[model samples]
Target: MRKFQNRSKLSQYLSEQRTKVSSIGFVPTMGALHIGHLSLVSKALSENDFVVVSVFVNPTQFDNKDDLVKYPRTLEKDIRLLKTLSENRIAVYAPTVEDIYENKVVSKSFSFNGLEHQMEGAFRDGHFDGVGTIVKRLFEIVKPDTAYFGEKDFQQLQIIKKLVELYHLPVKVIGCPIHRAEDGLALSSRNTRLTEAHREVAPFIYKTLNTAKVMFGTKSAQKVTAWVEKQFKKQPLLKVEYFIIADIETLKPVKRKSTKKSYRAFIAVYAGDIRLIDNIALN
Candidate 1:
């Protein structure tokens, strides 16, 4: 596998590659590689002639400075993990902050059409703006025919779709399925920070979501939400931040189930100092 730290060299290489390949697939990640990230890369490899996976922990996206500092960076291990997938077709771009942000590190203000103000955006101030900025920059630098993103960050997925629509970028944004642990905990880089005790109870988050999904049609959205909160309240190790059943398109909380529109159950929980978020589709 080819490794690139400089954006210009990578761009020049991709330019040379474009003439020979039918399609180039891109998977932008913040490193701390796991099965979840590998799944996205695997999908990208299957679809495109060449795949570019970026591993840069973007500073602009974190609202809490501590979270940014604590975020995992396993570059050498990440490259080794990537190599296990493919040696020739995959190029790993592990750029320095200076390489990605140049001089100033700031996010570009983007109008996500109220999609940004929903769940994650409501909590993390300017989080989506950071997400938009880095994603846009990476999209510009990579300029792949298609980009793959995991659906664990459903809101971000939708916003990126809007980002592409807003900018009219030629790249196709594809949302891959969420990868989870055998115990049902949604795979996240933050999962690395979970203490042994916290890890034990982490699967409860998904268990509660699955139970709530069964209660969707029989119980009101409000009741289901309250029940979810109560379920977490009983667990001392876990704390419910927000649990909302909302329409998939608009992302606004729905009071009643609508046959006309699709909905998903979105939940954010605080497991000790680490925060975990997961969602399930409620049809």
Candidate 2:
């Protein structure tokens, strides 16, 4: 697999490829390549002539310095996995912090007034802005015909959609389904940090959402949230950060209404010091 660090070299490589009219699919990641990330890479490989995966652990996305410090970095293992997945056809671009953002000058900030400030955004200030800036930068660097993002980070996906619309970018943004474990826990790099007991109990978040969806069919929104909160609260290993039955688009807590619409059951939990998020949709 070919690798390029600086933009000039990447641009030069892409320019040569463009002459041949090759369609590129991009998967941008904060390199701790879990199955969730590889799922996107797999999708890209299936649909495009060429695939480029950028592995840069973006510092701006983390609100907590300690979290950033402790964030997993498995570059050698990640590269080995990617090589095996690609079967020698994938190109990897693992850039240094200096190479990606030398001066730290953010081009423009994306502001989704209501959507950015709720749930995950409420807890981590400027988290989506960090997400937006880094993603936008990657879009500029990769300049792929299509970009893939996993739906595990639902809010981040929404924000990226908005960013593309607002900026009138040429690339297509696609959201892939969340990959999960056999037991239903959402696949995440953070999952590696969970203790055995917490890992055993973590699937309850999905179970709670499943129950909430069934209850929402006949019950009020308040009842659903209450029940979900109660179930999560019962888990000694899981501490619920925020639990809400929200409108899927707005991410705002929903109230009972006569006409049915879409809803999302979302949760962020702190199992010891590691934070994990998962959600399910109810229609």
Candidate 3:
């Protein structure tokens, strides 16, 4: 696989590839690749003529400095894993922090149709703004025909869809399904941070979500949420941040079960010090 750490080199190369009429599929990631990440890569590989995977931990997106500091950096290992996934057919654009932001003189403000005030946006202050900025920058840099993102970050997927419309970008943003482990815990890089004991019980989060999904068919929204909270409260290791049964479209918490629209159970849990988020669809 060809690896380019310089933005100019990568952009110029991708531009050249464009002249050849390459249908480039882009997978932008904050490093520490896991099964979930490779699943998105697999989707990109299956559909596009050429695939470019970016492994940069964007500093601007972090709401907490400590979390940023604690975030793992296994670049060498990550590249090795990527190599194993695709037999040197994939290209890696692992740019340094300086390369991506050296040109930005000022922070540009973004309005994601009020998407910035809910869930992750509400909790992690200017997180999506940073996400919007970096993704917008990468889209410009890569100039791919299509971009792939995991539905694991469901809200972020929606924001990017809006971002493309707002900017009138030509690239198609595809949201792939969330990949989980056999035990049902959604695969995450942060899973590495879970204590040995916590890791064993981490599957509780998904189990509860599964139960909540089944109950949603028979129970009211408020009662379902209450039950989810109570279930989480039973486990000392798994601390629930926010649990809600919300409409899939607006992402606003639905107080009552709706027979018309689809609903999703979204939850973020603090398993030891690792923060994990997962969602499941409910009709």
Number of clashing pairs per prediction, in order? 0, 0, 0
lDDT at residue 186 of model 3 (Cα atoms): 90
Best by TM-score: 1
Instruction: Say which prediction, candidate 2 or candidate 3, comes out ahead on TM-score.
Output: 3
* Ranked by lDDT, top first: 1, 3, 2
Model 3: which ten-residue window has the lowest total lDDT?
Answer: 100-109
Deviation from native of the Cα of residue 2 in model 1, angstroms: 1.2
Q: Report the C-alpha displacement of residue 242, candidate 2, in angstroms.
A: 0.5
Give the per-residue Cα lDDT of candidate 2 at 36. 86
Query: Which candidate leads in lDDT?
Result: 1
lDDT of 1 by residue, 1-283 (tens): 8899999999999999999899999999999999999999999999999999999999999999999999999999999999999999999888999998899999999998899999999999999999999999999999999999999999999999999999999999999999999999999999999999999999999999999999996999999988988888889999888998999998999976778999999999999989999999999
RMSD (Å) per prediction: 0.7, 1.6, 1.5
TM-score-wise, the better of 1 and 3 is 1
- Comparing 1 with 2 on lDDT, the higher-scoring candidate is 1
Q: For candidate 1, what is the TM-score?
A: 0.99
Candidate 3 Cα misplacement greater than 4 A, ranges: 103-107
* TM-score, cand. 2 vs. native: 0.95
Quantify all predictions' global Cα lDDT against the true fold.
Answer: 0.94, 0.84, 0.87
